[model samples]
Target: MSQPKHATPEQARPFLEAFKFFYQINDASANFFMRNTYPISIKKGTMLHKAGDICNHIYFITKGAVRGYVNDNGKEKITWISVENEMVTSIYSYYMQQPSLENMDAIEDCEILSMSHEKLNELYNLEPSVNILVRRILEKYYADAEVRALTSRFSDADTKYEFFLNTYSHLANRIPLTYIASFLGINLETLSRVRAKKRSIKKS
Candidate 1:
């Protein structure tokens, strides 16, 4: 693992802006968070955290993208992909303080700001507003997870693909098709066929 460098307020601004947009955190609280964060740069294909590793931090992507996946019987099953201005972490491991079941890696060279579990917890205790922000952030993550789970369970392949496109349109051209196929619970051939069909329909 590379050493984490301290983030300057300028580098932390985008992360704070994201929180402010979602949680309405004030400048003072945001500055507190900025002061506590560390900056890290990861190259494409670098695994930030792997299965069986403890997830001690949550990362905010200042730039680039990251994906979460699990190795299932020699196949990589992608769970989620997050891009710039988004947060990524093995929530199960971070919250439970156990070894992670998922692997998180950079899909593109990334600039990230990270906050440790210890500092996050301390912020929760030291700042009442921080607790509200944390709760809302967790709720948002939970809601998104639940929706994705339900969609995968009930939606057809074409419908799933459509949902994937709609939900991750920004990432469509950025991430590999194989990862997107796995995320949508479809095979690569099927995804290709679906794209071909859509293209033909558009031309007609």
Candidate 2:
């Protein structure tokens, strides 16, 4: 990740627009938020938040992708992949100020907008509407977490692959297949076979 710099109006628009989807933000609040948040550029393969490190801020992806994963006895177990126009962070660490258990890294070179925990809290206190905005955002995060947890338990690799395709088919050609296989909780060989089967079915 590169050093964060103050965001220009153009850079801040997408971040503000993402928030507007959850809650109404008046001009004053939008201006204040733009002033507080910063822009960062992350190189592919760079770790934004690492295990055992406290996550200091939450990030909004304006471009590219990030993946959340854990090192399980030297193997990577991918938990989630977030693309542009989405929020990405070490949730537990960001909220509780504890060390993160997973790593968040850039899967592709990325541009992101970020606001520190301290600045966010200040917004909550100073602008009451910001509380509603954050609550709505957290609710969506929790719902997505629940869905991911349920999906991870699927026992059939075919069913898992189907679900992944339904949700992330757009990313299939963009990201590494190894990362996609890990995210689906399937071995690479299994994923390849599944893809082959899908292709053959399409041709028939």
Candidate 3:
């Protein structure tokens, strides 16, 4: 993959906004966070972090999308997709300071602001509010992971597809059907049939 381009401060507003919104921090706090951050723009297909790599930073997407997946016996199983204004990180690797089992890659040309784990730790100690924000973010991440796990185990194929559509409506037409199928734990042919059936029902 080609090296990521450097992003200018003017191109970083959305990232700052997202950070403030997600963390519920004030402008001053957000500015402080941004000051310690770096910006990078990656092309589609760029791997942000591969399996077994330590995720040293958390990324705030200003543009484009990212997907997280794990390879299972040569099959790629997608676990999550994040789009513009969202954050992406390997939670286990970031928090535990260990190698990750998941791989994260850019699905579209992406501009992101990133903060290193070391900077995060410094902020946590310097600002009590940051500590609270981090706690809340972790809670949300855990809750979301639990929901995905339970849904995959209990939901039928159609139900899973429906949930995926609702969850990633913005990406329904943007990402490849194959990736979507993998994420929903269905084969490509099944996904095609499901889409055809839906289209037929709507046409009828």
The TM-score values for the models, in the order shown, are: 0.94, 0.95, 0.89
lDDT of each: 0.86, 0.90, 0.82
Best by lDDT: 2
Candidate 1 stretches with Cα past 4 Å from truth are 1-4
lDDT of 2 by residue, 73-127 (tens): 9999999999999998899999999999999999999999998999988887888
**Candidate 3: lDDT of 103?**
99
Clashes of each: 0, 0, 0
Which candidate, 1 or 2, has the higher lDDT? 2
| Candidate 2 wrong stretches, greater than 4 Å | 1-4
For model 3, how does the per-residue alpha-carbon lDDT over 1-204 read when each residue is reduced to its tens digit? 975544455766776555555577766666667577778889999999999999999998888989999999999999988888778899999999999999999989998888889988988777778787778767777887886776577456777777777766887899999888887888999889889888998899
- Give the per-residue lDDT digits (tens) of candidate 1, residues 1-204: 966567888998798778876678767677778788998889999989989999999999998989999999999988888898888899989999999999999988999988999989988777788888888888898998986786588457888877777877887777889988988888999989998998999999
Give lDDT: candidate 1, residue 21: 65
RMSD of 1: 1.9
